[model samples]
Target: MVLIDRIRYLLEKLLEVFTIFLLLALTSIVLAAVAFRTFGSSIAWYDEVASIGLAWLTFYGANLAALKRAHMGFPGIVSSAPPALRMALFVLSEAIVIGFFAVIAYYGYHVFEILAWDRLVSLPSISLTVTQSAIPISAALFIVCECLTLPEAWKKMRAGVDSEHEAIEEAIRLAEEDLKENRS
Candidate 1:
């Protein structure tokens, strides 16, 4: 259990770092493209590359959000429900999310395979498979994140804890602390 927790911690941290890098890369690519165009020297592959970067950013950002449980949800009822009901609802919701991502990942793999031979027009050296690969990769990441939360959900359920509310409150508190620190 300790090993699994450690692995999860490391994976989440890695995802966080990768997501930050993607954001920075995306921002830099866009800014560079804009500056080049303004200077009357546009890069032919800038659009294609920036689009791919944006796609990757969106996919990986979503996966990171899942890892943080930052996805939007109407958990009001669940948070106020009885322990048994809350547990059932949480489990059901998680199962649905996992199943949805599983289907996406499966189909995404097929899409990536089909596009493997197709290259981007502006960047003939790069295959479409490379850009489209983000779908399956992100889906897989999301599935892993969701699966990792299952044990915690089960433990909370067994302990009759309002984990959803607790998590939300904890996030709010952290945000407040960060704001205060920044102001200081």
Candidate 2:
């Protein structure tokens, strides 16, 4: 269990770093494209490349959000439920999330396989599979993030912890801190 936790921690850190890099790269690409177009010079493949970068950014961002337990959910009923009911609901909700991503990963892989031979229209050198691969990759990453957090979530559920409320409070605290830092 310790080893698993360590591995999860490492993977989460790596994913976070990668997501940041992707964000920077996506921003640069879009900004560059806009600058070039404004100067009356346009890169033919800029739009296609930017779109692919956006897809990668979104997918990876979702994976990071899942790892951070930042995804939105209706927690009112769950938070107010009895301990046993809360635990049951938590388990059911997790199952749904995990199952949904698993199905997407499965189908996304198939889609990738089918489009593997195709190439991007504007960027003919790049295969469609390369961009489409983000779908399954992100789904798998999300599953891993959920699985890594499952033990802690289970413990909280057993202890009747209002995770949703806690998460909201945490977000508010972080936001306040950010505002303070900016004002300083």
lDDT of 2: 0.87
What are the runs in model 1 whose C-alpha is more than 4 Å off?
157-164, 171-184
Error of 2 at 178 (Å): 9.1
Q: Write the per-residue lDDT of candidate 2 for residues 1-184, one digit (tens) a residue.
A: 8987897789889988998999899889888889999999988988898888888989999988888777887666777788878878998999999999999999999997689789989989999998899999999999999998888777766776677888779999999999999999
Candidate 1 per-residue C-alpha lDDT over 40-96 given as tens digits, one digit per residue, 9 for 90 to 100: 998898888888888898898888788767788756677668887887888889889
The alpha-carbon deviation from the true structure for residue 129 of candidate 1, after best TM-score superposition, in angstroms, is 0.6
Candidate 2 has what TM-score?
Answer: 0.88
Per-candidate TM-score against the hidden true structure: 0.86, 0.88
Taking every candidate in turn, the Cα RMSD to the unseen true structure, in Å, is 2.8, 2.7
